[model samples]
Target: MRTRLSRALPAAVAVLAVFSALPVSAATAAVREPVPYASPVDHPSYIVTVRRDLDPADVARLVGVTPVHVFDTALHGFAARLNPAQVAALAALPGVETIEEDGTASAG
Candidate 1:
């Protein structure tokens, strides 16, 4: 009985050590920030400013529209008269990092 107790003590200690080294759920949760709120767009055709790094070839393949101009800027803008499916497809393109409706630009 004494030998059996000694073996069980080592196994319990090893199990506790492994679990302590593993990440706790709370540690991962602390690193995440709450998502910001975005306003809704009310128009049928709205312009969107995409990330400037969006490749012309990738945009053409996914969205079928070349930007009005491309240069050294943080963002490039475009008009998209797309349905939900089209928007989702375009958003899935590799170079696209973000999409937000161009609030300042008027389509008319």
Candidate 2:
């Protein structure tokens, strides 16, 4: 009984260690950049309306490629404001086919 318990303890500890190292969700682990706009209401990032076939990880990677700040995120897309240079960089990234201005005004 003692030998069996000792072996089980090591196995349990190893299992717990591995489980703790694993990420709970791909989206949950996503780290977003901060927004510098004065008013949160006026600032909106580029709207990335993705199809259902797209993976959340890929969308997150596309968001990471853009240098501008991400204000909010959704299943289909995210809102962020990017400058011309950042927009160009984002457009160049894989899986990102378009970059458009949403016409949302910036706070003075």
Q: With candidate 1 superimposed using the best TM-score fit, by how many Å does residue 75's alpha carbon deviate from the native?
A: 1.4
Model 2 CA deviation exceeding 4 Å by range: 1-45, 50-75, 104-108
lDDT of 2 by residue, 1-108 (tens): 256886799999999998898878864768777875443454445655445566434564654544233323444444465545556666665665455566556899
Colliding pairs, model 2: 45-79, 45-80, 45-81, 46-80
> How do the residues 21-82 of candidate 1 rate in per-residue lDDT, one tens digit apiece?
97788568667688864434543444455566565445644656444444334546455444
The weakest ten consecutive residues by lDDT in model 2 span 66-75
TM-scores across all candidates?
A: 0.36, 0.33
Task: Give residue 101's lDDT in candidate 1 (0 to 100).
Answer: 51
Candidate 1's C-alpha runs over 4 A off are 1-43, 47-53, 56-58, 65-74, 104-108
The models' CA-based lDDT, in order, is 0.58, 0.56
